[model samples]
Target: MCGADRLVKVAFSGLAPLVIEDVVVEGDLIRVRARTPEVAAACPTCGNVSSRVHGFGLRTVADLPVDERRVVVVVRVRRLVCPTRGCRQTFREQVPDVLERYQRRTGRLARVVGSVVRELAGRPGVRVLSALTICLSFNTALRCLLRLPLPPLVVPRVLGVDDFALRRRHRYATVLIDAMTRRRVDVIPSRSADAVEAWLRAHAGVEVVCRDGSGAYAEAVRRALPGAVQVADRWHIWHNLAKAAGKDVAAHSACWAKHGPPLNDGPLARTTRERWHQVHRLLDQGVGLLECARRLNLGLNTVKRYARVAEPERLVRAPKYRPTLVDPYRDHLRRRRAENPATPIPHLFEEIKTLGYSGSFNLLARYITQGRVEADRLAISPRAVARLLLTKPETLTDTQRTRFDELSTACPEMIDLTNMIRGFADLLHPRPENADRLTEWITSAREADLPHLHAFTRGLDFDRAAITAALTLPHHNGGTEGVNTKTKRIMRQMHGRAGFPLLRHRILLD
Candidate 1:
């Protein structure tokens, strides 16, 4: 072959075994005319070599882009007659490596499209491919994505399992991961015990399964692989404890509320207190919750909430003030006002504006009119206090530490709750002695007067073995939880247009 011909063959090496005839650029498309090599070809069915050509047929196929332009290849293939005695069948020779059977695109181009669709499914994929000069429709891109094969399932010894919401409250799916490698294993369609149990029964090599506090999962693991060690996730345990501590903090809101400024008498607070009185008055007069809701023109849930609260003070929340330009100069304003209570608003605004305040003069006037400047103390909510109690001491700032200490010493119950939270947090660090520590922690929790902690202790008692394993073993479902988070992002990218099969395909392959 000449130098130009050799270069052509070398440049388009993907079309190996095909003789290049001509290459031309027509408009925006690069069209290549080629022919299959005139060699002996094997019959696909009977596995016999055929040399005699029956005829020649032309096939046009799309290929990868060349110089930001679409490439179309027109190749002349031979139709040979099989030489086998029993099968003298006429068959078309195929270049399997170059193109797939009955497909209009080359294998390499199809693989490129598959990769594009795999990451950006449907409309986004189409838009991206279109931008790259490759023509693709939305449904076509999805079809390409769906055609991609899933990875082979290999059962890992240490498995991590977690569930993510498919539609949130209506539907959910479970994701399994190899804890050691952090690679996703499989995604089950449902988060049911039966679904998990069936999976475990199919793949039997799992020795340690780490999961959350889902009873269905625990039950499934117990039934399917009784010999497997179950490790409860420490994050889930801490989350449950935070929830319980939040309830405990809320129940004793009076203890902390007294330490702060007087209760809010704003319009919202007044409305809440009035509604609570109205709901209770109706309930005391032999009226149903639904009747109270209808008579008061409120939703049933609203009426139920009011009836559930024993005191209206629990319903009143602290004022949540949004940050403003005046916040930076609050200390200056407070100090100036304290020195001279009769300070003029105009004078104060001018002073702060010179001190780098960028707020409008009217905004300063309104802040003073609202009495926020005089009201130096801000009311802390039970949820905020609960967060302080749950947060690690090392992570807390000096201000947060002071607030946490103040809330901790508000009542004897608060003191006990703080100790219990600390004890439970210590058990989260896995050690040989954590099992004993867990036992003592549960005993102390049950002995406390906090009803929320009592319920939390009951959950620990029910899942004792798994909880013990979590406190002792190092296995965790952190990787599985991360997979679930990625699954959520994938679902969001698909925009809920695709079904479980496509979702599973992306979760496993992507």
Candidate 2:
């Protein structure tokens, strides 16, 4: 070891321990040329430092990641001998950089391997890490995954609750994500009322909640967050609407299928006999069209048209062409729904097709959802009914307004539903009456429900007041949903291999 003023005494410190003598760095590789500090190690039998280099070799080792640089170090090492003349096998090879025998990298490098693997949860993120650094072994990476931080704690103002299963068609778990922050608030093991209630009650600060139409979530919200406003989410509202339309379509589907083909009046009239039964009976009895229309619930014009059709159109209805296609087997869907209502659609479709249903799934789904519209219509809240009634601007025409105003003044309860519609309108344009009317309507609903309204006073049993407050504020949890989507993307990218801690760091930092 020489220096400018004099040769600086940079002798190695260990008696026989391997020491670094010189170092070089090229890309991610660090080359360290070193040897045993002393010529030999002291023998247990002779207790003397033997002046011998038993053997010497060079080994390459990986190092911890440093900034944009990935690193590996090459170390030159030597084995030392014991001084005893007849000592059996008195020497051993040395290790460098806190590594075990046969280990290709330093301990810190192993930790880094573990850190990425645990953070990402598996190989997906590991592959990304591989592209950035060295191609690490799966086992090595897996060892450090799952060192994830516990998910963050959020005091939820409102929670948008939903569920998804890793594997479809069997198990279900309710997941609660904060409607304001969009962080996953909590996850319950099942859809059970008790589990949902327990979790909801344990956490406070949920003043409002948005949920699907499930009575399960409604009951849980009532039991746990007695003061929380329970409002139906927009997605559920639209879903309910689609379901309603499907039911109407399905109910009359047979009529459509039977009459869809152009037909001669003979067998066509017989097959669609139900469609013109009133006109036929009237004609058979020589009754007039006006009387027949009322009796058969058909339009007078329809009866007249049927009466005048050509004789060829007079026979029983039959397929215009041969019945080449087979009708769908409806029994299997009935069996499936009976056996397990929760089975996913794709699975159910497969099961029914196996049982001889040749119909397209859309048609089958239409049949399955045949009566859904009626059900959805029946389930429409007074609030929704009001919205629909007021949706058209023509409804607010001067003549219409006079009628509506009279209706409102005469039936205040009905007017309250209308007020909600108007409150929603206020969201489109700023108006003072909007807020005043919203508050007034809410107060009215509360006052009307008072005698049986202990909980109502607490602002949980009824939602009008909460809806009014929300209207006044004019804000929503849309941002939260966006954040949730991003969170999912982050999880997908990481592959959930990394433990929660590192995952959190990456998510927050990245």
Candidate 3:
């Protein structure tokens, strides 16, 4: 090959089929002159090969970077005339590998744009491309990504499915994953049974499905793949159990008030207590929170805080010493507490309000809280009890264990509840042999007199088959959750601006 031919071959080595004829470099831009290998151009309209050149045309196309500089391909294309009679047509000769008919960018450059969009997405992808001296706009890059074909679907043997919030507590979408390969299969727009059933029906060969506690997905799987084994996620089960336990502990709120330490005479307690009284006084006088706030010259939020609580004692803060105007009334408050330690703070606040007490309700609340602390040294918080019930005993410190033991003795109902929760936890672990024990635990929970647990057991009974399979089989929705986390990351990176098509492309293709 001669010098010019050598230069042409070297310039267009990777961009096959379109051999380069000349190379020109100016500033940061490199222009390569090229032509198609074929001498006869085919008429796109008539599909007739024509060697008779009707004319010559110049087409500028963007290409991949050449030697750290942006490359622009200037192709000297030939427009040809159709030879067959009555098939009047003249079309440009085409190099399909290098450029499409109307595309401004070469096939290689388009692929580069696609890869960048896949990695960085929209605006970020444009920024990255611009930084590399390859000019691109956010819209162009997004369009390139949107035009990408979908990934080939597979018939996964083990499928994992779950729902993730698109806008949280509002719009939600479902993600399906191949559990065995840990690759996302597809993402559906809705978390409904129809959406999931449609996806399951499109693909076959799913032997087992691991999913969260969504009844919709369970129903979808049951409807679409009756032969496939459905396994409930163990994490969701424990999560539900914890929520139920917390509710059960909260239901015994009176136990906390009765046995809790005295409301401390702290600044927070005094402030809240005063606000509580002010709110109640305004409400009793048929005044709304906004009007009361204006009348008291306080923030609407402060007045609303006061209005939210039913009793002044609920405003009492944790045990802490604080100097307040009610210090002079401490002696009176102590005497009242001694006479009736269990007396509610609202009653005491009222009694003190009649004795020339000009202090706020919070001042009396702090004093009352302190008195309760001194009087009730053995008071246990229901929240603390709830934490103990949820935590494994082996993980507790000595002090925590001692406190837990005291709570169990003080509230025998807690002992029965903990035993039942433990039994349910046991059924969730690697104990396929104990699958039948779940039914027994459900029965005990229904009769345990705890409304929360009864509700939880009812849910377990409704999905008993899936729950049993979860305990028996090794499959779980772990992969589905991981995929959802990845999806969340993508959503955050895109600032949640991505529409469904772009979002799906980023997830499945990338």
- Taking the tens digit of each residue's C-alpha lDDT, what string does model 3 give over 61-119? 98877678998998878888888887776777888857688899988788888899887
Q: What C-alpha lDDT do the candidate models reach, one value each?
A: 0.86, 0.52, 0.77
| Alpha-carbon RMSD to native, per candidate | 4.8, 19.0, 11.3
Between prediction 1 and prediction 3, the one with superior TM-score is 1
lDDT of 1 by residue, 333-397 (tens): 88999999999999999999899998899888877775667664555677888999989999999
Ranking by lDDT: 1, 3, 2
Q: How high is each candidate's TM-score?
A: 0.82, 0.41, 0.68
Error of 3 at 260 (Å): 5.6
lDDT of 2 by residue, 1-510 (tens): 346213211321221244566655566654455553554445545566665776766777665544446555556665666656677555554444444467776665666665665446456646867777666766556544533344566767877766544224775556576676556665555777788888877777777776655678878988888877875554333333334323222222222223133223555445456656556767789788888888877788667656644232232332222221123444455556668877777787787677766767776455445432122111222233233445555756685555445434433334443444454444433344555664554465455411212222233225444344444443344543454455566556643433444444444332
Which number leads on lDDT? Answer: 1
Q: Best candidate, TM-score-wise?
A: 1
Model 2 ranges with Cα > 4 A deviation: 1-62, 65-120, 139-143, 242-510
Question: Which is the winner by TM-score between candidate 1 and candidate 2?
Answer: 1
